[model samples]
Target chain A: MPTTPAPGTVAPAVHLLAGALRRALLEEGGGFRLARVLPGREDSCAGLAAVRVLGADALAPFVVKGLALPAQDAALIRAAVRAHPAPQEPERQVLLWGIRDAALVRGLAVSGVDATGWEGLAPAGSTAHLLRLPWVAMAAELVRVAGAAPPFAEEAVHAQLARSHLDISRGLVRALLRRDLPSAACLTRWLAPAGEQLTTPALDYLEIAGADDPRVSLDTAIARRLTTGTSP
Target chain B: MTRANTPISPQGDHDDAADRSRNVETETDAAAARLAHQVGERALAWLECMRGSFALTAETPDDHVEGQALKSLAELALAAGMVRREAIAGPQCADTAGRLLDFGWRQVGRGDLLYRLQARTPAATYPMEIYAPFAAAGYRHERMDRLAAHLLGLRASRVIEHVPNRRLAVVAAAATIGVTVPDDVAAMIGQTWLGGTPEPWMLDAGNAYGVTHTVFHLTDWGGRPEGLPQRLQDYLHQWLPVWAEVFCETRLWDLLLEMLIVGTCLQRPLFFPAVWERVAAAQRADGMMPNGLTTPPADPHAAWRNHHHPTIVAVVAGTLTLSRAISHATTAGGEA
Candidate 1:
């Protein structure tokens, strides 16, 4: 899920920038500019922070369109990569590895400059249904690049997804019942990509529920695309 | 672009996980039986202590004995009769059932009130509904039965439209009273909210209760499993656990208890020991059920007024699930 400004503080510029990048990815002709994406002298830290939060999705349109990665955009990613330490938390760690790997595939980071292999970090196990929900971020990142960066197609994750379809569906039901839309939307987006083939009544609920929160709107938009195979 | 080629997790595994969910293994059955009995016993101990709450007197400590208490008393008598008939709850529970039932019968004025009510409103269903449990316990009033038979003959009684589960209750309640005049139960079942087996993900608290009570009437409060259709049984097996988890999170303790009781009556006897433990834990030391009240209301009369139904529900859930657990064990032993 894209970040929401934490309540009670002024929403950071990076949060708005990340949302702009997400908006570009979703809206047709929303214009992807190399200059805007490159780390700049002012608020460049915030710019890279925005990309870090949005993860690989920040690079999606460039990667998908086969456009050359600008040298400055590469530097922007490198700066973001250098600034943040690898997280100790499992979900954050998964996010860290996914962002690094997305850069590697797109030629933004050379070997040894940034760590790449995300497979070892993919959440896999009996507790996946409960613990791995955050893995939706991994899927969300991967969805932006579609076929170019294959996170779900990786062997271990695919096997886990096979076993977890029911678990995923069950989690989706609970999330909806609890009125936890962000979770519900995340689970909905991840369902079919994780190999679950079923009607997502939860997505249908989100569509009609009229939630105006931008984060939920983005997640639900992506969810609608994933489940229905419509344009994002 | 690493074009994706790894096959999606096979449809075979998905179906297999579903298959596993439906089958009840022998060991699980034995453990569940023990657990179900424990939950019911603790709940019954509490209800017996608070048996005065199941009163029909015009007034109690603070409030009038109205619809809620009246319904609670009938359900108490119903649960007591079921336990006494099943005799699976052991001597102490059965003895508690016996005393509480005597208390319940006295509350109804030993059927005089029921007879008078039926006479007053021959078109009404509550009098027959309340009287059936008493008759099942051999507390007969010949006049009441005659009144019910006459009511059953009326073209009006047969056609009164109740929402599907209520319709099933009326039909099942008739059977409990030993009247053979039957309505089209299968037709009624077809009309229930659950009969069509609507979308499981859309289930809300109100519809959830509708689903639970429909199952209750189908199984005669868990006395018969064959009465549940294979289609509906399979439907519940697949979805009931998820529904139970949702309700538990919502803290609908009584609804969760009802769903657990429904689980015991399935042809395969679905068991979730964790859920049973949580539900049993929710019962207070003195046998008062929190029902769904997270905190007791400040007014004493309001607290007593709101208290009666879920506690009675606990008794039925306990009796029905414990009885099912025993039968499941018997069947398992026979197979072994």
Candidate 2:
């Protein structure tokens, strides 16, 4: 489990990534200069470039580690990606990189693995139906990045549950990274049955939706209580 | 018309920060009562002005008044009639409403003339505008039903020709009284070809008039059960604040009223009360609200005629929003 930092504590990874990003972009001065802080980190230049493409807001959750972004911000990133054209390799790496591991980004880029339904899937279609597709097919690239085998072989799962359940998978990625048990549990219960065919350990996390878990975030707490594998 | 303006706070006498501390039930009830009172007062004052004599001369070759000007009077009648029925503006307004509605109906050949008169309007000009409120007010005249059917046909013709946005007024009128639009018209209105284009006339996400009419039609004039699709709802949620700000700055009361309807449809009374405050502030002592801050014709009668449209719209907007807000607040309070 990633250590949950106190509020306002900037993670070292965030600072490092941000520092590398600053060095890459020679913008008009606004804040701290990255080149001055961390002189040489050429290895993560591609990651920095990717971060710039995907934007710091999208990559913030991974960089900050345990911090769960507000659902609205998470939604904005998805919307922004859908609105724009598909990015190239390094940029795709930065954008698709959900975890804190550099190796995962490399593996995702080289694997050239087609997320099951992504190829012919038009991003500009009805968002509701797009969200309804099987989670594995929808997040196939992320699954490969996370080293989880794809969920299905033939049939696709339609997300019959609320639209917010579609968002849970993204939230689950952050929770899995954080290893926040309560949060993961709540997300799993809500997402698992909806995308029943999905094959990931995160699916079996814990069904504690609505549990009075002060340790976890408010969203996760509410989600846990709302779904316990009993209620729809 | 105007681009950008500083944000105008909606915090009339109600401080939102303090509102947070107070119980939800109490706040909602208080807000409802206050709004209802404000709207009721304004509606009465507006009724007093509209109660005078209305012109009924047909806008043919001889009449000085353009058919467009007279058509607008009927639209005002429909709005005033709506307030009269709401029991907000006193019962005396009912006779005035009937007079205006009947006069407007008569001017448009009382649904008897088959000749497609282009009278001042760009496309076909019919009594589609007045038919909506007429039907809504429980007037069972066959002419209204006929006009509604004519509108549906016009909508069908508009769709088949790939015309955009022009059919909005007819479609809006139809929805005002719960007429189910044909599948073709629905398809035409639903999909936008210029999704990515910056063009202002794109029906889905451009031009204030098209957007407002689309919203009005889809939401069934703020009477739809759930209101617009999630995507459109999201779009309105983002741009309405900006649109409201601009319209309010330009002093475009009619468009601003439409914005209030959109706000009501989205169930965000909190975001819109500021507009109501602005409208209420703009009202003159004798109940005349100018169409905009734009200068009116120097002739007193011309100014009166010009001022009447916004005043009628303002009254309707206030009555509709306030009544809806009270209902919403009441429901919310009960739930709390």
Candidate 3:
């Protein structure tokens, strides 16, 4: 029996959790249950070597769900994140890139603490985390997300603009909202090569998004690329 | 002889400098007056726009209906309050009020709009913006109480939250409607200063809103000091001059107006006079206020919406600051 949903609190991400985790969230607490279910601190760092596999999509769902963690659990996740190798600490980096829960972001911003799991990824140059990653690994993840849809035509060299990548796009928007310029710029930079493989709207948005641009769309531009195989 | 050809004596030069300084003052005065008039007109325009149909521009179309509905109603409530207070007014105030109330009633109970808007998005400062208008409109219902409770709960639960602006917004909004702020909320605000007055994050585009929202909420939309802890007040009174300078240099009209309102809230007339001057000079003749003095978007519609933000800010800040300025002047004159 999950705790009766808090009135007016309907998180789309909450549904992504299995019933057992949801039950834990209800009976125990959001923070405690999340920390219990997450990859343990050892497991967290073990995945460090597989940075390529830990893309935003694979990470967003977990991080978004982890936001409900109580302080102790939140700290546990943070501690786990800290234990990871600096270069391969993609989970915390992704969260800091603005993939974490909305409330968590608010909590971090208000508490004046770095909610971005790892402490070293400062706001000033957080993109260094993403940029430091092997370009091929990052680029491959982008292709995987963008190419999830079937090809539009036989002659098309790239995948057609198909379904959207909600998690990645939402993270991008969150990054933009937090004014995490380093992260936003890093993500936008990664998308630049895939310019020829994007949808029209995605291409337009990419042209418009910058570290300093005030307005940003919640839509994931890169994920919806309508590349006709020609460079944008 | 042409004035340029005239050789000036020391006495003449001194007198000339004095005349030039006096002329500058006159020009500044003229500009302020012009801006005040334009702001008044533009405020009325914002109200009129709301009186018909209004959409929440800030939210994505794909956001949940509750988010949209809550944001829309909150904006409406604020607009209605603005109209009622004559912060933005027209003969259409009555009509706008009717439409707003009707719209509000239609979507009142559809979801947990209140909690979803407030607690779910704690960093957002717009929810704080909603408080003054909703309270000013004298809106009281079970939902409002629920919102008030949710805000209080968030404060109690999160020992220290991100976005000082959002914390201030919740505390200040609760204060506006006569809700007693929990000790924790007050303590939470005090915690912000514990880090030795967090330097204004002005370079971050979002902080422009965050900093101003902090000022507005801390001061309770320029209403009273009950919501503000004394230490925070002193901290703001000391640092506002520097913050206002930074905001002015950025030439962000929305922020400049927000800084003006902060000055009004603190009752510190001297804090942002230079910013006030620049804002007045930047006003267009037709009463539009652009987002900033930076390069605008290439698209015309995008450009117009950008203009809309500052124009609305100008209305709220202008109305509050100008009216307060007048009242202060009148009171000072009376005391003299």
Give each prediction's DockQ, rounded to 2 decimals: 0.16, 0.02, 0.01
User: Per-residue CA lDDT of candidate 3, range B1-336, in tens?
Assistant: 332221110112144755665456445444444455456455545544543334433343324544544554665555445445644344554465556655554454322344345556665544444544555566555565666555555545344445555666656666666666555555555544422354332225465566556656665566664445565566566555545655576687777777676666665342244565677677665555666657655554455545655665666666565556555556655865
- Pick out the ten consecutive residues of candidate 3 chain B with the lowest summed lDDT: B4-13
Q: Compared with the true structure, what per-residue lDDT tens digits does model 2 show for residues A88-107?
A: 33433323322212222222
- Report the C-alpha lDDT of model 3 over A1-232, residue by residue, as the tens digit: 1223233322222222223232332242233344444444554443322221222222222232344324654465355345432342443443332322222333334334456555523232112122222222332233223211111111231222111222233333333444444244334423333442222433344445531221112112222222333212
Q: TM-score of every model?
A: 0.77, 0.49, 0.44
The fraction of reference interface contacts (C-alpha pairs within 8 A across chains A and B) present in each candidate is 0.24, 0.00, 0.00
Between candidates 1 and 3, name the one with more favorable TM-score.
1
Chain A TM-score, prediction 3: 0.28
> Which residue pairs overlap in candidate 1's backbone?
B46-B287
Q: Please give, for residues A16-120, the per-residue lDDT of candidate 1 as tens digits.
A: 654555465466663566357444577666665665554554554444333445566656665665665345455544543543444344433321223354322
Q: Please give the RMSD to the true structure for each candidate, in Å.
A: 7.2, 17.6, 24.1
Residue B102, candidate 3: alpha-carbon lDDT = 53
lDDT of 1 by residue, B213-246 (tens): 8987788777787788999998898778788876
Q: Place model 3 in a CAPRI quality band.
A: incorrect
Question: How many residue pairs clash in model 1?
Answer: 1
Kindly give the number of clashing pairs for every candidate: 1, 4, 15
Q: What's the ranking of the predictions by DockQ, best on top? A: 1, 2, 3
Instruction: Estimate candidate 2's alpha-carbon lDDT, on a 0 to 1 scale.
Output: 0.45
